[model samples]
Target: MSLPKELEVLQNFFVKQPNPLLGVETIQVLLFREILDFTVLRTEDTRELNTVITPLSTENDENVQRVAFLGSKQKAVESRQMERLLRTAANEADYPIEECYLKDYLCLECPRCALYGGTNASASKTTNANIKHRVAYSTAFSLAAFEQIQQTTTFNGISDLTVQTGQTLNERISVKPATIFPSIVTLHSVTWKELILMMKIILSSHKYGAESRIGGDVRNTVVGITGGWEEFITPLEFTMELNSEKEKSLSAENVTKILNKYKLLLANQKKSVILSPEQVDDMLKFISGFEIDKKFLTKAYEDVRAYRDVQENSKAKKK
Candidate 1:
């Protein structure tokens, strides 16, 4: 009912390395009802729930029907006493044992939709949604009893704890990294562009490494759509163009084409400024063009633009 005095208790609670598996948490519950009462305790076991729960086709059924219990794993760490108590509870509650698990935390099959009856859109992928929802729901319940303190605590509340659609849990959860002492932090809004851009940067940074990129395909697709200009060009090619001494000798048609390409891919509200073909080209050229400081120029362009805008705003205010 109350939060543990020690935060270590909370961490240890989740990092449950018991006899069988690693990273498991156990919860014991004593349920009380009108006439019949029972108790049950279930431990979080690291049995992988990787089953894909999708709609099943029933004969001429317009309502999307699902196989309620397909590929369900019975690999829970339940004590004999806990099992007995749960059995008693199921009988008294007049619900099937399966149903109880489905409703409770034991249901790893599907995600707990907090906004099921409210506003959140229907989850696109059941497995992915379940994983996210499970983490969020468990986290919410785990921190439920923590009294909300001001700036120092609580992430300001539940809303602050949320990862926007494209944002990551690790990034959103802590206002700042726990290691960072005393800094202002903003909870970032999740955007598809942010996710795509982050993925591209990551992949580009480490594609040479042995570690497989998780979201490379999505990132590529996004680049193709957003950076319509330089999709076919490799980073190497882009570098060449950026550093080419022949740009001055090139025809006006070619110059116009290059500039137009950049304009097309620049950041817009419809989408985040992804690595457009033009920027990719620009970056490549920057890398290749030893004549000019490509990185410096790009960064300087951004800095100058921001400074000029700020100055303009100041002047306008004065006026």
Candidate 2:
């Protein structure tokens, strides 16, 4: 029914209903995800998401492609992350869960559709045509350069039945353990329950990038939440700012300080309220225990029906 006192400052950002336009409030979440095992993040061409760039510091003598995480990869994983919980919520609310995909058939009538967005081009139907993504994601690069973070290993495919190695060993290039990715995700026009759902996903998601089922164990650590009309701190900025500190010796406390650098600014106007890591931890714990109630899912489903009805009426009038 309400947010905890620690997260109360973000109450104003939560909208009573979802609106593509005129939803000015934004909640930017800061994260420092560390790779526990390894991940294979690639570019559109399927090659490793690494490109050569000038040396970030004196560590590198020449320019070389640095492996970086891409925004699309993050969005895909996050979008997929909501599937199970969304279906459960729909079942609890007594609504049919219409399956949706990344770029395939979009039902355009689910909470997942509302948050991640989708497009329906069913030539005959035009109701609720397009849904804009409420959650925004940006790419984050490893704090360590690609060379320093990458590891190559060969593994033989052994047959379970025969217990024999395959004809050839396969090579895998992945981000090594302890590699950190500083990322920020922005949520727009979301309700309190939606916000809680998002936080839960962030806390629970442990894998990212390719071969997620097998490897790619990245641990997500949300340092804080900044609420306002606009209070976004980019991953590039985080990487840059943290790079200097990293040159010496970077610690969790240093990262937290970097996250709060912009908080003190524009305080008079209430543009944003940045949470400290301690405060963030407290809020995370509070939301972890909360569940997505049936009432919230019901309202979301009702909105979908209302939108479809309105669109149908408009199309009828035109015809």
Candidate 3:
């Protein structure tokens, strides 16, 4: 089915970062659908699957595994995880942070640390000062069907029993590919450029949840922008209602209709612009040319190196 123009607009619009100068309040919600079966969230206690098809309930069951579930108050994606991913992406892009560490100091020279957070204090006997993260993530809910399976281990190429190991089975569970989960991220007082960088990291996320060995591709992303509205129907709520009405019969037309509904709701209240595909590409191109402060990084690296040398020399003198 063809995509609704409104939904298409939203999809297109999300590719670029919002303008910080406009001083408009905006929230971008992304739905990361799994493209492969993965075992990320698991229960603490091993239990057999029940007849009903639903998320494994952990309440009152101390033995149940602590898995990330939909509609749960617990965050599905934490800010720390986002920070780590961004750091990895930055390093891969050749924007490595030069200062690894100093005497109880964090390498704040890096973009990830600057955008996420960092600390300079060392651990004390009681506690340590920690840098607070800037981004906030919502709990993610599973939208696709799940299945339970038995995990196993086997050995081969041995003739004698003494020389061979016995086969064993393990307990495991998996969510099917195409399963969708809705997650929201709220940014506070960040520049448009920084937000764009964060978006790039998110869009580049390939695997998340538990097992990276098993693929868990982020298949599709749809971002919704809102201003002055602190509360709007969450993507989870909207998707749930749509799923109920569609009875799991997802189609292009139905999806488009849902997006249009949301778009209409936003348009009625405030001005909005959903980036087109071309616009998003243009933004990416612009970001490529953006330059970072090399002088700041150089100074940070030298300071960290000097501090390390002093610490090492003091230890040597004591010895």
Candidate 4:
């Protein structure tokens, strides 16, 4: 997924890679999600529950265990999950990747390595180097409070988003269907390709939270995107800004309106540019039509092989 030369102006939004990430340049994005079905988003069992206490209103005083989508949950969706999907797609297209998909293997050369930071999966600090994750995600909070918007049930018989009562004995807690979670994702020093791909991943991905293999169904929307030297806002702050409203849904218009307030800070107008609804839609249309072809996959594999060779050669020298 690449942009045209005319769109090179958008490159101003991303920091030039191959350089240190000073955090000054960033692309702040707002991602809104709706719970389509049963989704498990919990840390640990709290009396067989997975929730945390947090403010739930514009007042910012109330706190409760509304279904919270942790940052780690979506990070995995974008990193490990997206990487696995890419590999599968490549192999299906007959452009098989030599790099293993095992998480522990940490080929260290895949597209996500530098984009999603990780510990030296080799578990050897001296031999392997860690990559910095350029993208950052924030935990999303449900608009509806826990008591009103969550359901718990015990059942069996499930395959690909269906629940059967007699299949087996399983019990879990999930938020009510159609619940909304307003989120913010920040990208630091990402290239044009990385930024667009992130949008595709966010808007296209269907599953979220724990136990996603069976029953974590979600739909995500890219509300708005801002490019600037500073991160515009957080999920919590975005929530607060819209808390006064009765409806908690995402639309390109509302998103632009809220973010437009922060377009200029103090007397500086160059700090950021909040994309208009039309611009956002244009980008969305482009991504929907964009296809990752054999050429892209071939170059991706070549880069992976080259990076792995370099890392191996470096390790050998250190030995």
Candidate 5:
């Protein structure tokens, strides 16, 4: 079946090359400002401390793992959101539910689940058949370390009734009104349509992180795509330079300038295209009417079939 016009356009752009093996590589830098006070605990000696959360230096080995974890979690959420949108569109179009919505238990049967990976408890199977992800993040060190960003204090468990008791039962900590971080997400072997959808979810979504209760909205996001890995800026180098310049009292405006400079540099050095949030929104709007195509369903079917065959072969070998 033919895809939506918007999706078709993206697919053509992403798979322009003769070989589909070559997929688009994107580096997305997101600047997040905490709309509400939130806390990210620092653990030491198996105990949680209320120390101020700071950005991890690129030199630290743990930084990669932490950034990757954040990126992976974000991707999972974005994929789920995409699935919901698709399912709703299919329903509105009066498409067969079975053709569009895969049962939760039959995760392998769903295109989104297959791309994001899923576990089938009933079948006792897990499938990891999606694009590879390499990610790294840097703290808004310049703003945080220099205290240029506005921060406020809030007392937890400080209800009026609780305060009535003579004993103080509330704890207070500093929370920033906004936090900015630089992140790079690399996708391998993913289709253009999927990439565009993921980008839409990232840019359009307001909710993020563990602090969703208050509000961890992603305020500004910029994405740049490069044909080769060498074209992207290393997260560590970028963060370190920004942090080093903190002593200069860099304003948010100045920080953005620096980021823009780097983005331009990458564009000049490689075949790169920068996508603004507006562009992503436009694409999503254009594709809102589109439903899942037969191509996607066929791919999911093949993936499920291959997985079951492998499982059966393993069981037979055990016997």
Candidate 6:
């Protein structure tokens, strides 16, 4: 998907929060399938688990017959060590557990292990590990929790998020969108720019769902594009509120209020007029793009311009 112009502003203009909103959902699924299928490599130190420790018999005679103790040696089981290492990697990577619906699934550590006596015991255990690995290896899901990971990693700058899944390695990465944003409103279609902007807002937030986590002092953030793509890191809670006609009207009003608040915040900061006049114009464009009222736009423009004049005058006096 093509990045939005506003998002490009954020990516190109902002030094601190530069990053594109890449397809997270596609990547999540790819990672999930690959991890579950045991085709994807998660860590160099780990290998696919073929079996687990099973108890044969407690009696010495029975144990001798069933367990067949090979002569004890100092050799480490490469597979076991790999499994252990993968666990450690997942923990360290802060792999996201949400996309795989990890929350709904039975916890691996729980008393009732689903894989313990299940017919496909080995398959079940591998499935669980794969889910964990998906969250761990996923560049998008990993960054959903803390904003810094998204900003610092090269996840989005890479390519179309595709992954292969099967009982083997030669599979193709699944073709799908990998995003954490919730679908509140159903539009016929969305542009790449729109997707990226929505993703930035979603990624900057805590999680994706009806209950949005896009929190913080909204005053400190601005929605725009960077690196010629749509992206945002703001405090506005973007969720599909009541999708009725009345709710739509209320949402429009809320947008007005938010713009006014943002304007006031800009005024208070007395920061450099970093945003160009064209960028300010784009804000108006976005408002109109959504069919929002022009009143809020006019008011915000005046306030921002006044701030710019103040900045310019201050600079002249100092000169």
Q: TM-score, each model?
A: 0.16, 0.82, 0.54, 0.80, 0.55, 0.18
lDDT of 5 by residue, 1-319 (tens): 3344544323423432112134444434333333333433222343232233434443333322122114444554466676775566456655443332333443444445544554544342445333222222333332344244333444444458766435455442333445554444444444454554455555555555544565455543543333333334554444554555342323444444445566666634444444444544455466453334644444434544554465556667788
The runs of at least 3 residues in candidate 4 whose Cα sits more than 4 Å from the true structure, single-residue gaps closed, are 1-9, 16-23, 47-49, 56-65, 92-98, 123-128, 156-170, 246-249, 264-269, 298-319
Which of candidates 5 and 6 is the stronger one according to lDDT? 5
Number of the predicted model whose lDDT against the real structure is largest: 2
Candidates 4 and 6 compared: the better one by lDDT is: 4
TM-score attained by model 2 = 0.82
Q: Which predicted model would earn the best TM-score?
A: 2
lDDT per residue (tens digit) for residues 1-319 in model 1: 1122322221222221111111223211100011011111112243221112222211222222111111011111111122333345346645343222322333222111210111113333222222121111010010001122101211222345563354233211111111100000010221121122222222232111011132101111111212211122222222223224454222324433443454454443232223334544444333233221233223322432343345456557787
- What is the model-wide C-alpha lDDT for candidate 1? 0.23
Kindly list the per-residue Cα lDDT of model 2 for residues 1-319, writing each as its tens digit. 4455756767788876665553668888878788998788876555455544634543434444556788778878777777777776677867666666556566777667778877766332334657778899887877777878888878888999999888767777788889888788889878776787788887778878877887889888886687887755777767666666343435556656765665555433456666666777788888887666776677666665655566566668898
lDDT of candidate 4 over 155-274, digit per residue (tens)? 766666654445657777777778888898888867665665677778778887666787778888787888787777778767766664553445678778777766644244576678
lDDT of 2 at 249: 39
- Each model's total of backbone clashes: 9, 4, 12, 1, 3, 33
lDDT of 3: 0.43
lDDT of 3 by residue, 1-319 (tens): 2222323433322213212122334445444444455434443355332112332321222222212443222232333444564455556556565443323445544444444555655322212223344445654555433332222223245548687655544544545455666555555434344454556555545655445475444554543433223324454444453445333434434444454556666633554443443544555455444433344334433433443355456557788
Q: How accurate is candidate 4 locally (lDDT)?
A: 0.68
The window of 10 residues in a row where model 2 has the poorest summed lDDT is: 54-63
Kindly report the root-mean-square deviation of model 4 from the true structure over all alpha carbons: 5.1
lDDT of each: 0.23, 0.72, 0.43, 0.68, 0.43, 0.24
lDDT score for candidate 2 against the true structure: 0.72
TM-score-wise, the better of 1 and 6 is 6
Q: C-alpha displacement of 13 in model 6, angstroms? A: 5.0
Q: Rank the candidates by TM-score, best first.
A: 2, 4, 5, 3, 6, 1
